[model samples]
Target chain A: MAYNDKVLEHYEKPRNVGSMDKNDLHVGTGMVGAPACGDVMKLQIRVNDAGVIDDAKFKTFGCGSAIASSSLVTEWIKGKTIDQALSIKNKDIAEELALPPVKIHCSVLAEDAIRSAVDDYRKKQKGGVNASGS
Target chain B: MNRVDVCWSCRGGVVAGEGFCPTCRVIQPPDPRRDHFHYFGLNPGFDLDLGVLDTVYRQRQQQFHPDLFVSRGATERRYSMEHVTRLNEGYRTLKDPLTRGEYLLKVTGFREQTPENATPSDPAFLLEIMEWRETLEEVDLKGKNAAMQLQQLRDRMMETCDAEVVTLGKGFHDWFVGGKREGLAVAAQHTDRLRYFTRFLDELDRKSELFF
Candidate 1:
């Protein structure tokens, strides 16, 4: 299937493609996978004291749509508040990337990753001692 | 794909797997309702005897061979083709452990549990999958020991995949034979793992081609 130019762009030169110290309290890691297609994505965000996402990173192993979805989210989430990031829907991502109907799930996976990362961050904030990597 | 009980030619009541209409002697269309197991006259369960499946497949293939229906009416010929097609599909699905497990899940109404984005609920499992992918990323394909490194990784992934298959079989057995509903969930998880492992293996194979 032919990918849109935007998807190909993010896929070929994914931005902020890396990892953060999961042990860091400021870092929230979101790991998600697609069982039907065997695609895995790890999206992370570093939130500042004011609850603003200052940095985001991701590593995805799958098709171009999946890679592009995660890559696009990392770029979009930076500087946004956690609440703003939470409001980011998969449909928006799919539209931004011009994802096909079949690949909409890739965007959903990205959305799930971001939500999980935010949830992890919130859990850490609520339970400082009992957070992950403790 | 409905279960056709009456012969299209003579409209005679046809029993399941009766092959020819009792009155018209025309080949009946395969019952769409009959699942892969039922297609082979086997009980709907996880554990299956390959030898029995093979024998039954061959026997049915001969009994419903499309060539035998060439002189029959258009409906009979179409029915022969449909029967052969379903038979081939059933055989393929039942012959493999993974596909068979998947088919059983579909037949048993657990299909929704493994949708397109049905990732495992456990973070640790995703973490392990991420580590495996990261390992593949870390390996320098152009390095002198790249082939060996890739080989080792492939072997380890294969072993893990095999273990997952074993777990899947046990899970299916518990659900289909031992009457445990929770076994379906376990089987679903392993099925997801198998799907991931299969794709991972395919990726590894593609990368290994770089060595050539």
Candidate 2:
């Protein structure tokens, strides 16, 4: 269980760990869990009207792998366009973090969280309404 | 270093040549005997309440966990590690019906893999399994009505599995406490059925993801 020094550093002092205002229409929040490990993760994105990710935050409760995965994603998503952010796959995250095979699920969880948050933002835009505070 | 033999019954020191201590008439032995159930303070049975077992397991883990002996001597630390490891192995094996049944068979010195004794007595049960498999395969082929059917089957199978587990628990009590050794064989048979059923359920779950 010797993690990369960078991964361990991020896991211990995770950046962008918090929540966005639920009332913000451009803010998208995603909460997901892995049943196998009983781990939960929440990823949020604040997107501008032009579909550009302006800010990102996350809260994760799980193993070091999970924490590092979500922290990496939050850093990856900020300042990217919706399309660019969507292209960030779990495999890429796993590769960058050098996640072990068993912990690849943590990367997959991060990918799903990003997709869920972006999808929520798109849904709100389609409905021409404010965020539902879900 | 001088060696001293201790009597089991009297706790009195005995000479090396002496077979038994005069005070208690107890023979000196190097190792103490321990039974699995007695070690865990449980009556050996087929049936167990997993919730209660979980609590007991955590409590015992707290008592014997290696983390608690981080500052202890090397010998004491090694002893604690070995004790906790065995406890974990025993708890895991005894918690599952299939493993428990296999353990009971091993304890009773029945090592043969008897396929003749494998099949369940209930023909309808086998038929039900076949039907579920057929439905699963059909769904895989057609890819329609899968979600609803899978959900229904999952719910029903889960309920049935829970009930069967409860019955297995009662069977354990019957075999271990009631002195009905024959019941152990019956419990083992049911455990086999439960194992197959669990595998099928897992297959269905994996197949369900295909539709999604």
Candidate 3:
């Protein structure tokens, strides 16, 4: 399928395609998958002491739409607070990317990844122990 | 597609599935709505017996072989061809554990290609996958005893896959018998993990072929 200009650009130059130290108490990691398509994604975020997300990164092994969706979300969440980042929705991502109807799931996957990473972060805070990394 | 209840050839009561018409010996067209298990009259759980599946497959093949229709009408020939294609496809899918599990999910409310934002909610499983990838990357396949090393790792992976298959089988049993949604979810997670392992195994095989 021919992706729109925005999706194409993001796919071509996907931003923050890497991993943060999962063991860091300030870092939260999320791993998600679409079993239907065998697509797996890992998204991570580093939060500051003030509860603001200082940075975000991702590594996704999936189709172009999936890659672009995760890339866009990482960029969007970088400067936002945890609560603000959780407010981000899949619809906005799909609209910005102009994703096809079938690939709307890619946007949903990105949104879930963000929530999961933040959830990991919160869990670690409550438990007072690092569980993401060895 | 609608389910056929009568034999097209003899106006006899046909089996409620896409299997061949028993009365007139006519090969029926494949029913898209019927799952592989229903097509073969097998249970929908994961604890399948290949011996039984093979027996049924061979019986179907013998009854509907395309050669049996060479002297028949064009319609008969077409039905024969469809029968052969679908029967073989169903057998191949049901014979493999990973494919069978995925097929079960597809037939039971899950879309075969529906991309969902929900990931398998198991952190330990995620960690295991990451470690596997790391170990695979760390292997030096060009060094001495590389072949043996690779063989050892392949064996280990297969062992894990087999264990996961058994786990998924019990999960399927629980879902069907106890009607637990949690059981289905566990089976789904195991199925997802199995898919990843299958892909990794295929990649490793390709790499080994190159090495040799």
Candidate 4:
């Protein structure tokens, strides 16, 4: 299937494609995969103490859809509150990326990655690495 | 249809006291009596013996390979080709444990791929997946040792996957023999793990290819 223009654009030049310090309590990282197609996606966010996302980055290994999905989400999550980032859904990513039915799982993987990264950030906050254990 | 053991010649007498008709010296048609497991010369069990399966598959392919009949008439060649095709399909289905379980379920008229049936029951597995992904992202940014560390991590993940496969085999046996409902759930869990392992391996492969 022909890719959406936006998806093709992001895939060609993915934004914020790097990782921050794992030891940084403010950074949350997530990795996910779709078993059916053997795709892997990694997403990370740097959140301030106030839970406002300051930065986002991603890396994906799969088809164009997967690359676009991660790229789009990384763009979406930055500057948003943790709550807003958590609400991002696979359908939105799929629609935005114009992913075909077979590639919907790629969007799901992206959503999963976002949730995972947020959860990791929360865990680190609770564990007293970056933030004092509340 | 004539029973495969009976000979048409000698008034349906057993030829060579086995498969041949003694009176006409005619060889009987190949037996269609074998089930999928028996056709591959395996015990009728859910647990697969992959070594034996591979050996039998190779042997069967060698024996009935279409190339062997290429010089023969079109009819014989077509028959051989069909046999080879079926053999390959059957081998593929039986080789993978999840596919094998599904095939058995289909054969037994209990074919079901419901979401509940295919989903993993353990919530911890999902949590584990999340943590692993976090570690992967951490390593992705590390320039020099990133590829090497990813390979080592992937090797460990594959070892875990191999163990899961073995556990899946046990679950299959339990399901087939004990009619345990949980066997299906276990099978589904293993299927998920297998997919994750495959994805991780593919990632490592991509990184290695780019570096080298």
Candidate 5:
């Protein structure tokens, strides 16, 4: 499928495509895989002591749409607080990239990754360092 | 090949293809309308005999291959071409365990391919996937005895896939026997896992080729 210009742009120059120290107390890591499509996405966020997102990074192994979605979310979450980051919906991402209906799941996955990351962060903050609480 | 015309062998009304027309001696051509199981006259379940499938495929190809219809008229030739393609597709879909499981999922009316579907909340499974990837990555990076290592990786992946396929088969059997929607959903999730495992296996195959 021919991706729209925005998706291709994101794919060509994906932002913050790497990993952070998952063990860091201030760092929250979200690892998710779409079993249906065999796509795995790891999104990590570094929260400041001031309760703002200090940085965000991601590494995804999947199709262009998935990669683009992850890349887009890293940019979206960088400056936002945890509460603000939660507001990023899959529909907004889908609309922003003009992802076709079939690729809407890619956007949904990005949303899931973000939420998972935020949840991880919250858990760590509440349960102290190295918390793997469910 | 559904038409109002009569069958050439038994003069029976249009009948869907199975092994052959039951009343007549003719090996019936494939029907586009029928699912893969009905196309091959097999019961709609994961448990299938490859021997029967192979023989039926060979016979169907022999009867309808375009090469055999070279001397026939255009309409007959067209029908043969379509039927031959359908038969080959049916054979391929049924012969593969992964595709066969997925085919059952679709025919069982659990057709949604949404991303939110079955993300595998089981933390143990997620951890297993992570370990599997870490192991495969180590194997991918090593240079010494790469072929042997890739072979072992491939074997491990195939073993995992086979186990998952068995699980999927059980899910299918449960649904077929007990008629539960949850059974089909669980089976579909297994199919999802099988597909994920196959992607890794395929990568291992590619690495093995490059290593050797």
Candidate 6:
């Protein structure tokens, strides 16, 4: 039950905690949940014209570990390319947060959220309104 | 507890429904390996007759009463303790609809936890969750109509959760009775929804507390 200092720190003062225009073409939304713990997380990234993550935000409803996990990832993904953001592993987040073995799933949820967000962005770019029917 | 067919003390054959060995009249340990339905001597499925379950539970409780073992041997007393423990635990698990479905899923070889990809695949469900969460955050606790609004939301959420439970039951029935594999996935998805709904209700309770 005891959380590490880093987790507590991020949880108490989560950075970039908000929402973006999900309908905007540049915005990618990732919604993930852990059924076992009943935790829901929504992570979003707004990619700039340069194909770099201009801003990232998240809203998580769960334990401190979950909130910290998403909060940390949102901060990490900012200014990075979508590919770079995709490379952020759950292990790295868990290691950085010093999350306990049981809380490792929180980090995994964050990683999945990022991947999902990126996938959404790619899908939007591919066949949606952006498609020119080539 | 592992010796289901043979008695530990008398080494005699133990018949089904016989708590004590027929040959030596010694209490036999309850089989720990037995599934909950098997423990209750019922068919494994989602739909259960609560009356039958209640009757069996009461009968087993009386048969394995701890007081009945006090005058018996040390081994018999130990077996009695084990029987009562597992009986209570099993009865509690099977008595609840949600827990009962989950237990059936476990016995049917479904993973209890989420997989490596913990994110829910259903975008619609995710959007609903997010919107509900946003609504929860948007409610002003200091407003005069806050209590009424909270009650309305709670009622709506409770209705949704009740529907999910029904769907979950049907999913289990389809898998166990109808012999459909896809039913397992349906049960799993609804179970996930129920958990989220439960959490949302808990948050509602917290918000109500803050309002009051």
Best by DockQ: 1
Arranged by DockQ with the best first, the candidates are 1, 6, 5, 3, 4, 2
lDDT of 3 by residue, A56-121 (tens): 999876678998999999999989999999999999999999998999988998998998899888
Better of 3 and 5 by lDDT: 3
Decide which is better by TM-score, 4 or 6.
Answer: 6
Put the candidates in TM-score order, highest first. 1, 6, 5, 3, 4, 2
lDDT, residue A73, model 5? 97
Per-residue lDDT of model 6, residues B1-212, tens digit only: 34448777768788643578899888877765688888888888878898999999999899989898798889888888888888889889998766776677788888655453455668789789878888988888889889999999999998998899899989998888889988988988887788778889888898898765
lDDT of each: 0.88, 0.70, 0.82, 0.70, 0.80, 0.86
Residue B107 lDDT in candidate 4: 57
B1-212: candidate 5 lDDT, tens digit per residue: 43343565577865555434556544455555688887777889988999999998888788777887688667557777778888888888999988888788778777745344344375456556655765776774468677787778788788888899898888888888878778887787788788778777766676677755
Chain A TM per prediction: 0.95, 0.92, 0.94, 0.92, 0.94, 0.95
Candidate by candidate, in order, the iRMS in Å equals 1.5, 16.3, 2.6, 5.7, 2.6, 2.2
Please provide, for model 1 over B1-212, each residue's C-alpha lDDT reduced to its tens digit, 9 standing for 90 to 100.
33447776777788865678889787776766677787788888767889999999899889878898888789888888888888899999988777787888899998844588854488898999899989998999989999999999999998998899889888988987789999998998888888888888889999999888
Looking at model 5, give its docking quality level.
acceptable
Residues B1-212 of candidate 4 have per-residue lDDT tens digits of 22335554345666221323566654333345545676676776567778998998888788677777778667556656666776788799898765676666555544454231112234356446645655765676348887788788788877877888787677666777888868766765566576666566665666667666
Which docking category, incorrect, acceptable, medium or high, applies to candidate 3? acceptable
**What are the candidates' C-alpha RMSDs?**
2.9, 18.3, 4.8, 6.7, 4.0, 2.8
Across A1-134, the per-residue lDDT of candidate 4 in tens digits comes to 68889889988998888767867878887766665555656688999877799899887767788888898898898889999999999999988877888778778888888988888788887787544533
Interface RMSD (Å) of candidate 2:
16.3
Instruction: Tell me the spans in candidate 2 whose CA falls farther than 4 Å from its real position.
Output: A1-134, B1-36, B108-125, B140-145, B209-212
Error of 6 at B11 (Å): 3.9
Error of 2 at B163 (Å): 3.9
**At residue B121, what lDDT does model 5 achieve?**
78
> Model 2, B12-122: lDDT tens per residue?
887543333678653333222333444455655665667777787788678667787788667547656666776687788878776776666556554444232121244
lDDT of 6 by residue, A1-134 (tens): 78899999999999999999888889998888887777889999999889999999999988899999999999999999999999999999999999989899999999999998998888887756556765
Write down the TM-score for model 6.
0.89
Candidate 3 chain B — worst ten consecutive residues by lDDT sum? B110-119
Q: Give the TM-score of candidate 4.
A: 0.64
